[model samples]
Each structure stands twice: as structure tokens, then as C-alpha cells.
Target: MANKDWKTFMIPYEQAVEELKVKLRAIRTEYRRKNDYSPIEFITGRVKEISSMLEKANKFEIPHDRLAMELEDIAGIRIMCQFVDDIETVVNILRSRQDMKILYEKDYITNVKPSGYRSYHMIIQYPVNMASGVVNIIAEIQIRTLAMNFWAVTEHSLNYKYKQSIPENIKSKLKEAAESAYQLDQTMLDIKDEIKDAQKLFEVKSAIVSSIMNDILYLMSLNKIQEASRFQSQLNKLIEYGDVSDLNQLHLLVRKEINRFR
Candidate 1:
């Protein structure tokens, strides 16, 4: 493809990446809006670089005309999770989505790679609305725990740096590090409930504090400076050394004051 042709070719893939990122992020936001833990901690996406795409096409013997059809990762989305179990949850969510059609899935987490790389890959056909018409593009979604992602990212950097010819000793060390990261993930899983509970408590407290602060600001806006100042001083002490119950009480008091003003 010529330079201009390549740019034109990438337009739909870029649109697909941006659209998928927004949709996937909305899932996380919806979960949080309901005061629930989201399986997806975060999402990131990209359209394959021109050089990388050309390299892969050459390596795989894919013809330029068939690149979009054969190159599944031309548009890639990575979903990062806090726990290993969350990968399955995210996969199920994607499978249930109506916006994209799942072509196939690769369960690398269950069947770890020889190089100790682990991730769940989903190949999906997503429809992108172009100025010309609607086109279905192949996209790859990778779901993995934070530890797995960290290890994979390091491994990818090494592979790039070594031009896919990593030294045996370094490869061995990388494998060992991958195992360590998996172990860390497993250890976290063992205490997952406790960690979740702690996080929930923190979020609840944060929400209450936010409500209290907003109400205090409302008082100041109402020209009740002395009252707002008093509440602000109390909030400062509570934020420094108070628990959730204390914050709840302060929030209730602020709400009552706001109600009186209204």
C-alpha cells in the first residue's frame, strides 16, 4: 500500500479502536455506578502501527490485499483486571455484547504458552460505520490480570529489543519472573474477599466524604459562611482520623442542613 493508501486503510481500524475503548470503559463505569466491583479494572486499545503491520504481514506471508481479513490484531483492545477470575467475567461480558460478533476465542490462561505468556484472547468482528458504508473489521481483545499484563509487557519489550532472538539465560529469567507473577496473582486470589471488602469500605467512605464536602460548599454558596466554616473544620478532623461511621454521621448532618436551606 502507498503511504496515502495505508493512512486511508487505517482509518476504520482507528475508529474501531476508539469506539471499542469507549464502550468497554462504559462497562466499568456502569458497574461503579451501581456501587459494584467491575471485573475490568481498565481498558486500552490501539490500531497496529504501519511498520509493525507490514512486519507481521511479511512474517505470516499475508498478502497486502488480505491484510485486513487475516490480521486479527490490526485493531487491539486490552482489558486489564485485578484478579485472574475477572478475566472470565470480562470474556463472558464480551460474549454477551450485541455490538460485536465473536469469531473465536483463545484460552491461553488455561493453556499457558511455552514462554509463560498467559492471556485470554478473543477475535471479534466489529462493525465500523464509515463515510462510504458499514464495514466489519477483525479485532483482537486480550483480557488478563494486572500481574499477567505486567509480565507480558516486559516480555514483549524484550522480544522487540532482541529482535525475537532473546538469549537463553535471559529467557530463563523471564520465564521465572512470569512464574513469580502468577504466584503473586494466586496469593492475591486467596485473600480476594478480604481485599474486596476493604475496597468497598473505602469507596463507601469516599462517597460519603464527597457528599459532605459538596453540602458544605452549598452552605457557603448560600452565604452561610460561619456554618460552612464550622462544617469544614469538622470535616478536616474527620478526614484525618475518622472512620466510615463518623463520615456517615457528618454526611447525614450536612444533608439535614442542606434540606433546611432548601
Candidate 2:
């Protein structure tokens, strides 16, 4: 393809990556807004560079005309989770979504790659409305725990550095690291409930603090300088050594002050 043609070909894939990132991030935001535990810790996406796409095409013996159909990962999204079990929750959520059609799935977590890579992969067909018309594109989604992502990223860097011919000693070390990462994930899963409870408490305290600060700001806006100053002093003390109950009490006091000013 010509240079201009290649640029044009990538437009929809770029759009697909941005749109998917926004939609997936929204899911995380929605969970936080409702004070629920979110399976997705974060999301990232990218469209394949022209040089990399060409290299892959040449390696796989794919024709330029068939690139869109054969290259499943030209546009990719990665979802990172805090625990191993959260991967399943995210996969089920994607399965139930109506916006994209799932083409198939690859469960490397269960199967275990020879290189010890672990992740859940899904290929989906997503439609993008262009000025000319709508085009359906293939995109790949990978869900994995933070440990797994770390291992994968390190492995990828080494592969690039060594030109995919890593020394056997290095390969063995990589395998051991992969197992260690998996063990860490398993341990985290065992204590998931305790971790979640702690996180919830922190979030509740944060919400109360936010409410108190907002009320103080409102008092200032209403020109109740003395009331706002009093609350601010109390808040400074609470921030240093206060529990949720203390913060809640302060929040209530600030709210009452704001109401009185009104």
C-alpha cells in the first residue's frame, strides 16, 4: 500500500482503540461511583505501528488485502486486575456486552503457555462509523493480573533486546519469575476479602473527608469566614489522626454550619 493508503487504513483502528479505552474506563468509574469493588484496576490500548504491522504480516505470510481480517491484534486493549479471580469477572462482563461481538476467546491462564505467559484473550469485532460508511474491525482484548502484566512486559523487553533468541539461562530465569508471580497472585487471592475490606474502609473515610471539605468551601462561598475557619482547623486535626467515625462527625458538623449560613 502507498504511504497515504497505510495512514488511511489505520484511521478506524485508531478510533477503535480510543473508543474502547473510554468505554472500559467508564466501567471502572461506574464501579467507584457506586462504592463497589471494581475488577478492572486499569485499561490501556494501542494501534499497531505501520512498521510492526508490516513485520508481522511478513512473518505470517499474510497479504496486504487480508491484513485486516488476519491481523487480530492490530488494535489491542489490555485490562489489568488486582487479583487472579477478577480476570474471570471482567471476561464475563465483556461476554455480556452488546456493543462488540466476541469472535472467540483464548484462555492461556488455564492452558499455560510453554513460556509461562498467562492471560485471557478475546477477539472481538467492533463497528466504527466512518464518513463514508461503517467498517467492522477486529480487535484483541487481554485481561491479566498486575503480576502477570509485569512479567509479560519484562519478557517483551528482553525479547526485543535479544531479538527473540534469549539465552537458555535467561529463559530459565524468566520461567522462575513467572512462577513466582503466579504464586504471589494466588496468595493475594486467598486474602482478597481482607484486602477488599481495608480498601472499602479507606474509600469511606475519603468520601467523608471530601464531603467535609466541600461543605467548608461552601461556607467560604457564602462569606461565613468564621465558620469556615473553625471547620478548617478541625479538619486539619482530623486528617492527622482520625478514624471514619471522627470524620463522619466532623462532616456532620460542617454540614450543619453550611445549613445555618444558608
Candidate 3:
């Protein structure tokens, strides 16, 4: 009966989580539309389950009445990035937001936890406009690289399974894995410029392929079947020979073909 009541009380927090997730995802969409690099690879959020909340309250010896005031992470958001430096970019973006006030930050990345946990955690006070009135809720945001998230996720599962008493051997292995993930992130950062150039080439090639396909369809619709076939055949050869990568070069080729058809 108490758990049921707690679930009902958590409705606002659940709404907050969903709202924040949508907003963060929209930021990612904005970056892609501008053909810009986005530090956030993805966003995920969740409201704490009643049982988990209760467990945490009990662990902290919190009275029932103090639960709401003390529990900051009832609403949580996680942003995953591709590189460790990207985590700093994400933090800066959050800090610049006017909608939510950043209460404080915990830099676990610089000073890793004894358990080998590493992430950047921020506590923010977000206003959730209610029908009755505006209520400010505290939400915790954690940012991590893909590799750091992978290790944290695995470690979390093991902690749950062992109830925080993981075997020594397993713990050692996890520590090693965390170190390896850190090294991998560093290596990626070292070659980030090259990786970005390759990605830009891919996007350009994709755009050209899509434009060529549309042009082929337009020609076919105008009963220019022979012209369409010739254009498509040449396009296939160009793609097969790995010729279309630069946007300017693709535009030149497409312009010549388009002028011929028109």
C-alpha cells in the first residue's frame, strides 16, 4: 500500500524525466541539421522506482517526510559522448542553459571513485510547470563517454548481483577494464581530427547518392528512360570506383548531369 502511494507521488518526476529526454534529443537533432559535430551521442532518462527510492531512503536513515527533500536523483538523465573531451563540452552546454539552474557538480572523472567509477554528475533544479502552479524539481545529470558508460553499466550490474560485495578477482578485472576504457578514449581523442574528416566525407557521399537517386526518378517520370538508365549506370560506376566524396566535386558532376537532362 505504501509502495503504491509512492508510485502515485512520483508521477511528476516521471513527467520531468520524459520532458528532459525530449529536450536533450532535440538538441542532438539541431546539431545534425546544421551538419555540426554533436558532443552528445545520445540521451537517456528515468525516474527512480518506488522500491529503489525506498531502499535508498532506508540506507540513508531518512524519515519518510524528508524523502522528497533529500532525494535529488529521483529524476535522472544521462548523456553519452564519444570522447572524454566531449564530456566537458556537454557540461558547458548544460551550464549555459537558462531553463534549468545547475545547483552543483561532482567531477568523478578527474577524481575517480575508489570503486573505479568515473562520470561527471550535475545536480540541476528544473522547473516543471504544473496546471496548478510551477514546482521546481531536482534532477541529476550524468555525462560519460561510450567506453566509460560501458564499464559503469557492467559494474552496476555486478554490484546489484553481488549486493555490493563483488569477489576480489572480479573487482580486479573490472578495474583493469576501466583502465583499458580510459586508454581507448585517449587514443580516439588523439585521432579525432582524422575521424571527423572521414565522417564529413561520408556525409557528403551520402548526400550525393540521395540526390542522384532523386534525379533518376525525375528523369524516369518525364519518360526519359534511356537518359535515366545512362545516368544511373554512370552513377553506379562512380560509386563503385569510390569517386564521389568531396561535396564540391559531387556538385560539379551532378550539375553537369542535371543540365544535360533538362
Number of the top-ranking candidate, with lDDT as the measure: 2
lDDT of each: 0.94, 0.95, 0.87
lDDT of 1 by residue, 1-262 (tens): 6899999999999999999999999999999999999998999999999999999999999999999899999999999999999998999899899999999999998899999999999999999999999989999999999999999999999999999999999999999998999999999999999999999988988888898988999999999899899999999999889999898888888888888988
Ranked by lDDT, top first: 2, 1, 3
Q: Can you tell me which runs of candidate 3 are displaced by over 4 Å? A: 1-4, 245-262
RMSD of each: 1.4, 1.3, 2.3
Candidate 1 TM-score, C-alpha based: 0.96
lDDT of 3 at 247: 39
Candidate number that wins on TM-score, 1 or 3: 1
- The clash count for each model shown is 0, 0, 0
lDDT of 2 by residue, 94-164 (tens): 99999999999999999989889999999999999999999999999999999999999999999999988
Off by over 4 Å in 2: none
